[model samples]
Target chain A: MSKQTVFLVGATGETGESILRALLDDGSFEVTCFIRTASAHKPSVQRLKDKGLKVVFGELSDSTENLANLLVGIDTVILSIFAFDVGVEASLIQAASMARVKRFVPCGFGTPCPRGGVMALRDLKEVVHDQIFTLHLGYTIIDVGYWYEISSPRVPSGKFDYAIMVPRNKVIEGGTAPNMLIAKKDVGAITARIIKDDRTLNKRVYVCGDILTQNEINSIVEEKTGEKLELTNETTADVRKDLDQMNRAVQDDPSNLAHKYRLSNAQYNLSKYVRIDNTPEIAEYLGYIDGRKLFPDYVFQKFSDFVNDLAAGRVQRPYPHVSL
Target chain B: MSKQTVFLVGATGETGESILRALLDDGSFEVTCFIRTASAHKPSVQRLKDKGLKVVFGELSDSTENLANLLVGIDTVILSIFAFDVGVEASLIQAASMARVKRFVPCGFGTPCPRGGVMALRDLKEVVHDQIFTLHLGYTIIDVGYWYEISSPRVPSGKFDYAIMVPRNKVIEGGTAPNMLIAKKDVGAITARIIKDDRTLNKRVYVCGDILTQNEINSIVEEKTGEKLELTNETTADVRKDLDQMNRAVQDDPSNLAHKYRLSNAQYNLSKYVRIDNTPEIAEYLGYIDGRKLFPDYVFQKFSDFVNDLAAGRVQRPYPHVSL
Candidate 1:
């Protein structure tokens, strides 16, 4: 385990810096950064170098021999790179198996999926995820679901504002009160802790950075920014229509869908991860505290901060869902 | 042209071998083989080394760096490697563009496609093919219909025992030919010609090794071998039935249709490549005199030859397509 080396792709991206800092801050693991050039040296790589981690640069078109020099001693890999197709994950996994790399942590940092949730997908990530069953390497997808860092600002988001794509008008059959939200820095902290802990090895670690319900966030935003973030809580049919509308938007713009894995999920299961009671292993992970209990008031604080930002027009507006 | 170096993946695979021989035989092109070995000796590598082709091995899991080294001093690239995932082909093409490789030829060495043929597939290969539009590199996919290779006498094929998987009786709807067959040697020849020909530089060059029909092959086997061969035609419905039944059989069996890609293609349209008329490019390349004009006596001769082999037990009998 001490000999395991982690190769990081797209280390300069948004989420990469957190993982890089986490991995580098801990001295137990060795890390390698696969960069293309020193011409546009990323501060992260320099930081990793400054902190005594190895950095390598190479082309993806070159032969295996040419790149062999870089992967010589690597064991684990953390990939966050985004391309036109996330299906490249499978190829990378295949290559990793060929190279005899041991463990892999894919960029599945989504909500900790229910077992069935992962199986229902036929998307590129799902296809690649399925291949893991046939390969010899061990993989643990750290589903730090919908990081607080990346979610839409809920503060100033009110009646005039949309309900974060989920419906606000009708009563959700189950209602959306269970999920716990987490800050991105907390996600980074959890990631560092999980990897550093031998107990979590080969286990699906559900790290809800801060646990707060969508309802709580909404209420919090209404309180903080006084904006009514009206979710279209219509009939089931209407909810489905809205979900379809969102999905259609993503599909319409392939470049956008490609970037985010064509999200706009059809399930309308956005708040599904609100509760960590979903996983028995998760219950066991922290002695059954479940994520929400850990951060009881996460949404109100996060949403308030988000509303402050929205008031300043700090974040980009919702992209129009046009057909591709 | 003299300074143009070409990179070839799958250099030792069946199609790669042909492309390699074609590029090397041209004498005007420089060639490099990207292999999987890291300073390890492989039979294919030795052959290429003997022919003065540089060999570079790059892991698919690592960064694109290995490919970049070969990209330098290279102006054109013939990517015969089949990276069947979504972004891999695009990424490599993007790398080629980055490397400034002017001309790129993808491994599109199969029959010309209609709207729904392989061109419409969402698989990794199609994903890579789609990248052609996004990437600035000049690219062409040479579509060679099925190749018919003559087996050595020592390992000669017995009887007219060739198995072509088609979607039920609708095989003709898809690009795959139910009747037409191409010789393997001709496949090599045609692709070699396509690579060397300036006329097909940007277009799909199609070629058929021979214009023989499926029924003719079966009939010829009876005539040639002086034996009766049992033919089993599995319709798409029958295949689906079997596949559904053998869903459990695929767990341990390799030949089960339950898990085979062939079963999944039962709904595919296969008639396009079956008809020689659909492929004017290949028909032109072979100088077709038309099957109707030359087949009366020739069919009898070929059928008899195939039949004699079957009678002699030279050809292996096919398994019945019953669900396991």
Candidate 2:
């Protein structure tokens, strides 16, 4: 049988790198990475090229006709672009439709956000989802809760930085609610399996490595590292106050780039700590198939294991800086 | 004070004509109508031009740069385009933002649809609304209820056609749900007042000329026209059946244009007769300000008055055919 050809965008980012790695390691499908001309000469992109991964140079701002020509004969297209670049997805999706791609996997690798939520980011994501559905394009939407790398306690070593992660010793609102978390590598492996399986076509696939609250996560880090970190409880009211201030700032100056970024940061934190709508039950209610149920034999890396890796300095920093 | 400069799209459309007439009659704004090259020479377009309305030849498919150039010096931009043309609104909106227009009124001149309804058309409209809000542009969203011209009993003289309206002498469900109704002229006048009021800035304005059930409307028409039209009840189950069949056709052949149009028509019917989300109470809960409350002194044309007009042959068919 001929190998399936996959086209990937945003291949230099952390999640995109993991996906590219897994697809390459699977060795069953041909993989192509779409990179911006500015990033075409990076060492990481050069490494992928050396590994026999085909690279295409182009920008998302390119015309739909041009992008469609680049997507000819591609079986599936995976998007792992940044959230801020979401507005451009319309033209890309239209290009995919014009190219007659078999399936589309959009960049929705986050919590299960119901429509009409407080997060404008999720609303923007929903627009992309709706557009694909309206066009009758075959799609598999994957949302893998929060990343353990971001939710875990920050390593004290100066080698790694946590720009947007929660503070080191803060527990948000008793932190008893069970939140989903996954390793980035698992997201890649699951995505690889999902794309190869016909059962996941035109469905939402929810992936989770472990379900742990903020307090439980902290407990694992403390037990694994023996650091005796002191924790403080931050009330939901405080979070609401901060979010309100950020919202007002954006409202007062909608065109201010800095204020918009700060507002998005506040909204991200709210989705992680204050919103309880991302639970497994809610996901099921929203018609998502559990990834664990789909691939029961595959073992998942636990949060405790990640904590041990951080304590032993065995975990490499994925990126220099993470934006919310 | 100087008159506000307005740029209008869909000027030849029925709703757009009313809005244009209202704005021109108010004498408070200078209006420019954007027309496609094909429509530029039409008699309707000629009439608008004869009335001293500035006419610009352009298409929605125009590039954002080109559209922005046409919008230069315009204070507010109003869209009254058809639902199928919604995908083109993004570029036009981006152009408006680039031109730094003070206010934008999107093409939402229909029922007050809440987010995440059964209607795909409404979902598309919500995407436009979200885009405007995300851009932080000055805007007001307007949703009038069902149009009296479309929902009223058909005139018997064969002067008008009801291709997409409810079948003659038929009542949907119990026909007791108080649906909002407005004349096209009222939509125009209310929109004119809304665009001029600072209190409606960055808000949703719900407009209604009257609120009546299908049964009440039938009785009024029968008494006024004295044409004993027998009414048959169409159950909600039958409507759901039709909608489900249309949905399956679209799903089976998403690329079929005919199937898509049929599905849209079924969805429009379902939204009008099956959904209860367009009520004034629901709109209020969704944070919409009532237009009647905003302008209590302006007498609106009631449904009864519209029935009398139909009986007297004083009403004109706004368009040859209304597409769902």
| Top lDDT prediction, candidate number | 2
lDDT of 2 by residue, B155-207 (tens): 45443343324333567787877788998889999999999988777777898
Model 2, span A87-197: residue lDDT tens: 687777889999999899998888885555467877778878866765557789999988877776553443224332444456777877678898888888889999999
Top candidate, metric DockQ: 2
DockQ of candidate 1 against the true complex = 0.01
Q: In candidate 2, how many Å is residue B20 off?
A: 0.6
Interface RMSD (Å), every candidate:
22.2, 11.6
The sequence of per-residue lDDT tens digits that candidate 1 reaches over residues B11-127 is 776667767776666666677777766634866578877877788777544455655655787766776554232244545676787777766777655544332222223244444
**Candidate 1 structure quality by residue, lDDT tens digits, A1-324:** 454578887676556666777776676667787776752376656775786667777654445555555666677778765533355555566667767766677765555432323223324444455465345356655665554433443333343344243223333433454554555555555665555445444444565644555566566656766556546443445545655676676667755643233243334243243223323343232222233333444332354565565555553333224222
TM-score for the first chain of model 1? 0.66
Candidate 2 lDDT score at position B305: 93
The per-model DockQ list reads 0.01, 0.02
